[model samples]
Target: MSEANIDIQLLDDVMNKTVVSVEESKEKIFEIAENAHKENNFITLELETLRNEIDLVITQTDELEWKAKQARQRLANISRGFKRYSELEIREAYEMASQMQIQLSLSRDKEKHLRERRDELERRHRNILNTIEKSENLISQMGIVLNYLQGDLRKVGIALESAHHHQLLGIQIIQAQEEERKRVARDIHDGPAQSMANVALRSEIVEKMLNQNRIDEAKVELRLLKELTRASLVDVRKIIFDLRPMALDDLGLTPTLRKYLEEYEKRHHIETKLTLLSPERRLQSSIEVAVFRLIQESLNNTAKHANAKQVEVKLEFKPNKVLFMVADNGIGFEKQAKGERPQFGIMGMQERVKLLQGTMKIESKPGKGTILFFGIPLRIEENTKAGGSEK
Candidate 1:
């Protein structure tokens, strides 16, 4: 029993066991198919996500490109600023150089003018120094030649003075000679002429008497009056000849002086003396005239102012000089007071002497005889420049 039943149970148990195995196999196959389907859906979702991520990446790239363009514009602006700054620096430097050149030219012109002024001042200084030196040399040489020359000049002056003094003596003698001639003429006209007229009247009377009837008396008287009249006519002719003698001009000064003196003494009945010392042959005409004029003035003064009875005349001629004097024993005047006007004769004589570049001296005392002395130079024209010479 047990075997058959036990075999059967064992088979059954084997069948059930096979059945459970088939079920498990089916569940596994279904599970595998479902898992495969879920896997496929997940793969499709992942593909869609990848497409969206690609779009986001495109937007970010566009933003980065825009930033790069802005950076390029900023660089261009910086370059332009640097270029403008360089141009301004160059223009300012050029203007500064031009101003320096103008200042240098003005300084050169001032230097040239200063140099010319300095040269002119130096020339004037040298000329002034030369003039001062020449003046000093002339003043240093004036002291050595004074005394000997002065003595010689004084001697010459004295000789001239003496000649001037003596010059008038000739004129005085001439004047005295003329006075004698005048006295003679007067005596003849007044005394002898009237006597002859009386004699002529008596002769006419005698002739009338003879005609009437007294012949003898008439003849005697007539003869005597005729003889006297003839004699007087002859004397008158002789006086005419004596009035201007040729010897006065031709024979020289001394002869004329002697002739004049003799005539003066005879006529005036006064004492007059003459003294002559030097020979006189020839002299300058002006000098001769000066001597004569001096003599004439002296005699005139004596005659007019000095009531003298006696006059002495002296003429002396010496080497380089001539002197003459007229001295009268007459009452003299007092010496003139200061500032007194000159007397006419004295002034005339002084002027004559001065004209010949000479001097005159007069000496007199009150109640004493008056003396006039004149001196002159014989050759004044030859030695000095006096006005009397015609040349």
Candidate 2:
């Protein structure tokens, strides 16, 4: 056999083995997730039982307390009037008070024990739920890896040995793409798909109302269905826009950004300002997209974690590079603290800028705010080589 043929055979064999190993690991993780789910369910039931027991014990303790109080009052009265009561009655009253006190103490102890157990079980349940979530996430990530290995990685085997850095970058790109696809899928499922289902159900209800000669009820249902369908359309358009904003192509970067910021401010109720330091013009398509995404991610982070009420975005069109900045008056985070890395969103933004041969800087502190800066080169030839032109 030719050398090339032999190499191909070896590569195929290696890939097959790797795929099998990944599959086995995925199965094991799936089992762990399944077990964690079962444990979470069991803990939930135990928590319910413990709660009921604690309530019952509390009621019993309250009853014992009342009885003990009554017994103590009776004993005090009998001792004060010793000559009017028999010796047997006094002894009985004293014993009754002592017994009631003991019962109340025991009931309280049992209640305390049951409450402690319930608290422990609740903690365990939370831990188990976390475990289950982590396991499921791991399984999903493994599936992405497995798909990459089985499909795209196999095709890239010949180039792998030659372009090691390129291979790593390619993997990152693939993972990002997969993550984006998952986000789109989730948005559709939770938004438009659900709305459509509700619309269908409501349409049926409207039809029944019309058949029953309930004209007013039918009109109300029809109005609701129309509103739902309108909302569904809006959700779908938003998803499509997220995928690729047509405005970016038609109106160019600045206008697109202005419109986006307007909508974002309205939606998040955060005051946002956009300042253009240079003449408004378009950069390379790649640079424009990257800038938009970086800003979008920064804004999202601010909304999600910053607790900021106001944000400022600045853009400068330089002779050779475009400068972008986003600053927020939010509760910022420590940069590279003792053992923590930058958040994944920031890391991803940095990667995107790096891929475009750009520079990025982030400044943040605990009580202060955060500021991110990007300087992207406007080299036509290089950007075209990296990402195609607008046309």
Q: After superposition, how far is residue 276 of candidate 1 from its true place, in Å?
A: 1.8
Q: How would you encode candidate 2's per-residue C-alpha lDDT over 1-391 as one tens digit per residue?
A: 5888788778888988999999999999999988986676567656766786788998899899999999999999998899999989999999999999999999998998898899899889889978976886787699788877876567665665656666677777777766667667768968996687677667766786788999998998888888999999999999998888888888888999999999999999999999999777766676788789889889989999999999999999776788999999999987696777778788788777877789999999987999998998888664454344333
lDDT of 1 by residue, 1-391 (tens): 7786676567556555654554455455445534543443343333333343444444433443443344434444444565654655544444434443343344344334434443443344344334333322221211111121222322433345564444454344434434444445555755566556557556666876778988787787778788878877766765553444445457655666666667655655547788876555445555765676566557656767787788888988655677888888888888888899779668767766765667677778877988877777767453333333324
Sum up the clashes in candidate 2: 0
Error of 2 at 309 (Å): 4.4
Reference-based lDDT, residue 145, model 1: 14
Q: In TM-score terms, which candidate is top? A: 2
Cα lDDT listed for each candidate: 0.57, 0.84
RMSD of 1: 78.6
Worst 10 residues of 2 by lDDT: 382-391
